[model samples]
Target: MARVKRCLGIDLGSHSVKLAEMALDGAGVRIIRMLAETLPVGPDATEEERNNATVNIIKGMMKKNRITTKHVVLCMPGQTVFVRRIRLPRATGSRLHQIILFEARQQIPFPLEKTIVEYQVFDTEKEREVEVLLVAMKRETNEEFMRLVRRIGLQPIGISITSLALFNGQDIQRINFKDISSKSGGGLSGLLGGKKTTKKKSKKDATGEGTSGEGVDAADQEVLADLGGVPAFEEVRAYVNIGARSTDVAVCKPGEGASVGFIRSIPLGGNHVTLAIQKACGLETFTQAETLKIEKTAVLSGSFEFEADKTLYDMDACQAATQICDKLISEVRRSLDYFISQPDGVGVDVVVLSGGSALLGYLAGYVEERIGVPVELSSALGNDQIKCATSYGDEFDYTSFKIAVGLAAQGLGIGRLSVDFLPADVRSMRDFSGQYVEFAALIGFIGAMVFFGSQIGAESEAKYKLTKEKCEGFTQKNTGGIERARLTALESKRSQIESKATVLSDFVTPRDYWLRFLSHVYQSKPARLLLTQVVCQPNYLGVTASGATTGGANSGAPGASSGTALPSSSDPRSGIVWIAGEAEQLNVINTFVSDLEQSKGASPNQRCVVKKATLFRYSSQAEKSEYFAPNPSIKFLIRVEVQDEEGCLLTRLDSQPFMEQTALPAAGAAGMMGGAENGGDPSAMGGDPFQEGRGGGRPRGGPGMGPGR
Candidate 1:
């Protein structure tokens, strides 16, 4: 599908503003609307007043016609804009632009900074130099014009000069010069049928010879050559757009794709003719002069006469209008002459007239006769390239809209000369507007990223909070179980300590029984006999009987011999205490054995009696005497049986109550017996007796009373 675009072409003329609403697509241009609104300000009005009036008129026209398009292309008045066709050395790209810029600065009369210059390059493939069409206008002039258009809320997309626009308005593809020539033949003859020429000129007249009696001048021959010699298709056409205040002229070579080769603007136009008529007839106002020129006045030509009943005022207006028209024609001819005199010039084969003032009576015929070239009025009525809506009636002046159509064509990218005089600021604004969709898409993408990112962040935060809460609850539940396990371990350790203490106590209690037995032995020793050694063995009967010394001899008793048996007991707790002594006489030996048999303990029922007595040897004088003095002594052995009725001799005793009762008594007895053994002085024992008993008491006899002695 082809994209469609609509634009309004606004021709801001000095006396009138014309608008054409054009719709363009792949097919071509379509005219949706056309309107012309005349400005009410007079020629003598101030520039500010004129601009104000033009803006109001344009606003009214758009409103009245219901033309709503704001995108418009404007054609600046030719007089206010500079147009030049320059030939330069062939170049392209930046090099060409630089050359054009240099040329613009040199060609444009105003300073380059204060001027807006635009240019278009013509097809120069066949030529050695580049042909460029340069158009420039003062910056202030262009800005002020654009400001007035903006006052009506219209956007000016492009700006062009009137002469170039007129050149663009010519549709070369649809323009058949043969048809135009045929149509022009009738119109010219019908308007100028009474005119006659005296001489018949031919090409030979250029060499001072002709087919007639009088030869034509060199200028007349040149005019005839231009009028008659060129083929219709190869003809070069000049477009003269006679506007209200200025006339714009454009010369184009049709052979070169209708490219404009020359352009000029003349100060004389339809308004000048109206003013001339006004001054000649002494009209009260410009309005009346304009009316008269439009209604009755026409330019005079050779042999052409007005109606006899034509009023004198009408005739005066015609002559006044003719003189101004002749001057305008002379200026147009001079422009054509200048264009022809150029090095690359071609004679203008035909002249086409357009604009509001081109509608004057006999103007075409008079210009054709004066310039000696065929003249045709330009129109868009039957152009196939531009479709016009029938809603704008047949009475519409299509010729006056040529510049507007050209502007619309330029906006549609269809003009031959595509130069635009849009200011730098306006071009930037248009470029920014063109990229609006891209900007919108960028903003939307950023918004989507932000929205999604925030959503993800919020969801992550929620999940983190949930996980944290679960972990805290699990920690709280495990704390109590840990404390209970720790307390159970402590209780088990305490039980182990108590059991160890009980085992230690059982080991300690049995030492008390030995202390009590030792006390009994010390008390039973006889005078003048020293007890040498005593050994008490626990679980002694559990040993073999051969190793026992339970039976021994008694020496001093009557009928006693070396060996004597004492009574024996079978108690397992009844251990043997072996006793040894040295006596001074034999009687003393027998007496010591008797006293040991009578030994008692802490309880009345506890007895430690001698079980056996023996006389081992008799010594005459004491051998190395320590215990026996230097008297005859006998050495004897006695074995005793100690009965532990209270069970104090048991190896393991856990009876805490019984152990406590015997503890103090056993200590005191051990102390007293230790003193008696040391010659009845308690100070002779070095340390505590209780400690000595626990550690195995010291030997009872003197040191020399050991077994060797």
Candidate 2:
């Protein structure tokens, strides 16, 4: 049997938590197990108790699995994060970054300093401009997550948005040939924040929506001709995932070539009923309320639902379900409106609903009339594909399990969309102007050396004449040895000056020193541009850069801050963020628990967030009180450990280097006090280490780290 790689998808919810794990094999993605753990939040349960109940569910899973995760993708709640679509200059280097930072500061709701921000470029036109989707979550939220995931021994590599999971059901890049296939609003997306432009459809855009098997013979002909492979019909159909609180609609339209369509959560969700049940019954113990609500209020109620024929929900339950149906109708209307707003507005042909809530017997009928779209129970992946997936027990709920199945199916090479969309080398710093200054300074020194050589030559000629005369005069006294010693000493001084010509003569530019630096720069691998203030700043060439090659034992993660002697610490958490979210605030309860589990030795997991903030209200003398509190916001900062894997703290030298590096500009420049102005070397670098490599790869204050590090 082939070893199957497991993909686990977890949905963090207020009332109930859902987990789905699947394994991928050659045939396809298989469903392994699906779980909907009862969330014990009750009307009267203490917040702390509710938090623990949520945390324990994940903890129990880890215990049963026996191994911590290697790579895990997590999601944030739909409510906590802010998402914005932005437009910036079509740039790829540092300028691109500068613009991104600038845009964030100007547009994001919170100050740029207070958020764990990451961005994705959804649409790119290398020459024109780029469209990016920026997401910012409270740093406290991320920190808590780090803590929790660590507790269970999993590396949470990428934190994706909840809405993104719906789109994962289709390979938008491969499946979307034109604007229509991309998404209903992809045409408008192209014009997002740009000039308004309407999409014009091509013949490919006219493709009618159909099942992946509708043109099975033609697909088979190509498949056999191309790879001698059979067509996968069962796996290629569309799926609609219904969640506890929302509905995700997507259709992997299929014909010979079909359109790909996706629409996000319908306002209608199972949580509506749960909330209704909670509100209507006023139950303190949700453990019991949840059962009553699901059994009585949900569509699968009566004998068809999970429980026995007993129904806990009554007339009030009918009201909740009716409201849910109403919400579904509104969402379906909006979804179709979105479709019509697209380049072609061609509707999807097939839709399969999946989610525990989908089991409601009357839901299809209720949703069908409103959606004006065909609906059916989701079918399992075909036999070959199923063989690739882990065998699930017959009791597994297909609806709740579809996310894990889809995420896992990504492993089977179905709808694998990268949560991380930025290119690896996108942030490269390419400005090499600093090197030109150095070369120019070296040339100036060389020119000065030439002048000195001329002077020395003149002195030598005079000395030669004097020496001959002295030889003549001293012939009788035999005093030539002292004269020769003096001449040799003068020669040695010139040699010493020549040796320092490159560095000592820095900043004195000659015409065209750029060509000189460029000559050697091509050969310097990993060479970086640092402090390239090329515009008339004397210090531009007077740039004192410190860098080093890799040496000693190095861990493969980002080292520390490059003690470039910056007066500021990039880490928002260097001290306390005087805002609402405090250093002590636990935003993500489960994550905090995980971090607590991962905490080793003396260090507790640390997070940087704004504790409090205000609208910058300025007042007179007595207005400000000593007891005033700041609402700290969230920001990005990484965790530092005294230890490495296998429970070893980093070497003292290693940790100390970063600390000093992080602290240098604060401590070092504080003492320098205009040293550069008073004949101090602007190029006089602190003998710190980060000067070794380029970018954030090397640690702070290390010899190899470049300026950006």
- How many residue pairs clash in model 1? 6
Per-prediction TM-score, please?
0.56, 0.43
Superposed on all Cα atoms, the candidates' RMSDs to the truth, in angstroms, are 43.8, 29.1
Candidate 2 lDDT over residue span 386-444, tens digit each: 43323453433355555554443333223323332111121111113214567799999
- Please give, for residues 293-393, the per-residue lDDT of candidate 1 as tens digits: 99888777653454333553388898998888888999999989988998778788899899999998778888999999999987545465455678755
In model 1, where do residues sit more than 4 Å from their true spots? Answer: 1-4, 172-233, 306-313, 380-382, 392-396, 460-709
> After TM-score superposition, what is the CA distance of residue 239 in candidate 2 from its true location, in Å?
6.0
Summed backbone clashes in each candidate are 6, 60
Worst lDDT run of 10 residues, candidate 2, spans 532-541
Q: Which ten residues in a row have the lowest lDDT in candidate 1?
A: 657-666
